[model samples]
Target: MSWSMSLTSFPSRIQTHPTIHLLRPIKPTISSPPKFPNLPTIRSVQGNFDHSPITPAKTRWETMLETAASLYPLYVTAGAVVACLKPSTFAWFVKRGPASYSLSLGFIMLAMGLTLELRDLLNLFVQRPFSILFGCAAQYTIMPAFGAIISKSLGLSPALSVGLILLGCCPGGTASNVVTLIARGDVPLSIVMTVCTTLGAVFLTPLLTKILAGTYVPVDAVKLSISTLQVVVAPILLGSYLQRTFPAAVKFVLPSAPLFAVLASSLLACSVFSENVVRFKSSIIGASLASDLSPVLCAKAILSGELGVIILSVFLLHFAGFFVGYLSAAIGGFREPQRRAISIEVGMQNSSLGVVLATSHFTSPMVAVPPAMSAVIMNIMGSSLGFFWRFINPSDSKDSPKVDDK
Candidate 1:
């Protein structure tokens, strides 16, 4: 957010002094640590003045792109509807199977990595190891446990239960970083928490899912671990490596990365929904017909059945995660912003990872549904919570940089 004057280009027809070409390349400076420093890392280095000044036209285009990328929840919801009504619309993506799922999800991880600096991740951990570790531990323990309880209490089907549990066992989502910014929370902590939990998920996700979901169905922990390594860890590390190794190229592509992630996540979720459309339809139809009622009442009856159960179970899982995550953070004596960051991080799972994992390792399509629904539901919830926090805490409305001081 800082700027420095530098020499600029002239018309080729004009001769320039030798000193004119010696202008130094500007390094972008972040405003402050927790005020979403990395956010602009993915955006253009507008401060780099060795080139032509930014045009209003280009700024408008970039704004349009950013707006499209930020409406992630709407995109996911619309994709789900389209998939349900016209399954064939997403058949191409589904027909490709694991290859498709892995690629889509992997790209998202890569994009996230590009937005990071490995050194920053390390600095954050060194600065606040306890806060980050506590959040990560809660992420693994609280959600998975609550997921199991909710599924059982709701009396969901075996496959649906595994889906909910798997969703919980996964890591904090990238969307949480963005939500934290909106909530005026500790953006730096949110980013670090997401990265740590995602990387840790290579081990924890498989182990936890195997333990909690094992009751509903057999789980091969080894296979789950391998799948996670391939689909999650590898892509993220590769992206980080590329960012460090090729800074110029990374900068060039950074603006497009977020849009790509948004599209890929939306497409992947909808494809899964389309792939499992038959099961969804059958479940709904059967549930609707359970009362043996007239066709006019079938629509309402559907919500009272298996589909309803899955929806309710998934909703309860996230709701409890948000509430419990906050309560735990407050009890730990963390400040307000840190609590918001932890709450959002814990409440929103990497549902895309869950969808990919379920499809790759589990035979049941129903096992993928809860995560698919989560893709639609969690964003709405996260955004609403962010708005609520931002408005209620007037003193914290602007992202305060004091997050790192603690």
Candidate 2:
């Protein structure tokens, strides 16, 4: 019944197969990763390798998945373009209404949970509480504030402003974990920060949205809290529990989880994009505040000035999050790797969660647009930053030890 015993009980196929490869390493390790209690032996993500033998077909399959996952931003971009041009393709995901978005988001969170080790997250916190907590605080404080400022400066429509702020208030996205790995940063630090901020979002997201975005529309904080629990907390907890209880089963599917999550995330955002495009085509761009959705864009809205403003706002919001996040982490005296981890964790957000909350709760189609847009923009920005850091040298202070390059 013990965790280790359960892990040891993995079927021989899994024991021999090494069923996952989440990253293509910046530098592959010589030997298979050591089984550190605090670390999962993901080959590239943690700077380790799986020297275990496997069939050629399995290797090719994993390579394709890894390549696909690495190009996640492109997939998101393509999905958005498709949503803009052929909105009908994504109509099925929205056929069930907002409930569909929530379900898709829940499934993605579950996938994220299954990939995680609860014990590792806990031990990470016990050992490095300040860095994680500081990063979480910045995630809440910095981005939400940026959302407010940018919207005001850009004079975004009320619905769009709310969408932007809500996007900011949501927790760090699960995507940051992979980006952190690519950046050659402290993957454990990034993962722990993400977990902390997400749990915290159940409270902070609603409260902050109420404060920053309340003027634009009435925010029922209580309803928001309950929804967050249902769509976000519940699935993550269930997935983590499943991961612990059925390690082998989870392991069997781990190889494909990230790729699946990537596609699902793209679909969710594209669903919103298509919905807003429909709303725009129906001449609903400037609907009254009480109406269903104050539409932000149409099929041709990409050429419109308002769409330009929305893109600029989203870009500025994330750019500031990345900039301020790194500067703050450096100020906090973290090393280069930890700084990059904190920077990424603060910069990228759970924008899909933002999209769901905006669509499910807010009436304005425009309210969902910012977060949907964010889902695309943040990934592009984060991935670029990760690669930029990855190519550079990360030199810690002479006295201090190098942070978890494992």
Candidate 3:
């Protein structure tokens, strides 16, 4: 009652006397802060992301393709050059007689000669001698048999028949070593087998040819032996010696050897082609005879219409060699790599050598046909087979036993 009355009185008084006092303002102070109930705590940052690199495994097919692609241009160029070379350019070389041919042959032999030391041979012996031996035996046995049978059945001219047999009698090629490496086979073993067979063939090739081809051609064993010694053995010995005595020179030579070999082979091919061009032309013309034609026409037919049959047989023989080599190694308890080496060594033949001999000695284009065809066919077939083995038998390649190079 007093407060209300006082306010009213104050209002009346203020109205009456228009003067009043003002009150001062006071500040308030805070006591404590509130906290969040469920907030998460912060952690340290992660280190920089990893940036390590990775590598992929290489494959046999990749190797084969790479090597083949690299070599194919050289092969084509060599073939083209040989085919186009003026006959007159080579005529002088040929007319200069057997001596020039012998010299060229000698060069080939020297080029082929491997610079394998005693240690390499010892390594081969300790690692896989049996596998090597079996491969060699299978190569010699099956190939010559196949060749003889095919040649006889085809009723080819005697010179041609003998030529086929000689082709069979020859050793596995140095090229096989390269192919084996591409296939991821045992390269060292392949080299050993190639070298061994080549060296052995110095004597065995002539003996085998004389025995098998005596009826078909005048295989003068004595003269042939001398020719082989002059053309093959002497040069090989010289080359091997040079490689051993002059290692630096060999380093330079080795890189160019394949190219030189190709050139020499192309020249040899040209020489053969020029001489046999007429015969090959005639054979092509003659091959068109129908199966039911007269005997006279059949006889006139080059390779006796048996060319097809012989080709088929040779294809079979090649496959057989591959199989035999592989199986033999497997049976002998060899590891995967050695088996692969054996298979390759058994399958590939030195057809170039055969072509050279056929051209030099037989002088028949028909005789040269088998080796010429073989040179082309084997590469195609071998490469295809290698692809299959790599794709289908990959585990066999990697997990199978290995021969220690050491």
Q: Considering every candidate listed, which one attains the maximal lDDT?
A: 1
Clashing pairs in 2: 46-406, 292-363, 293-364, 293-365
Runs of candidate 3 with Cα error greater than 4 angstroms are 1-101, 283-317, 363-365, 390-394, 397-406
Best-to-worst order by lDDT is 1, 2, 3
lDDT per residue as tens, model 2, 141-218: 999999999999989999999999999999998889889878888777777888888888889999999999999999
Clashes of each: 0, 4, 0
Poorest 10 consecutive residues of model 1 by lDDT? 1-10
Please identify model 1 stretches exceeding 4 Å from their true place.
1-58, 282-299, 394-406
Clashes of 3: 0
- Against the true structure, candidate 1 reaches a TM-score of 0.81
lDDT tens per residue, model 1, 148-242: 99988988889988999999999999888778877877666778888899889888998999889898899998898888888888888898899
Question: Mind giving the per-residue lDDT tens digits that candidate 3 earns over 309-334?
Answer: 44555576577667777877777666
lDDT of 1: 0.80
Better of 1 and 2 by lDDT: 1
Which scores higher on lDDT, 2 or 3?
A: 2
lDDT preference between candidates 1 and 3, better one: 1
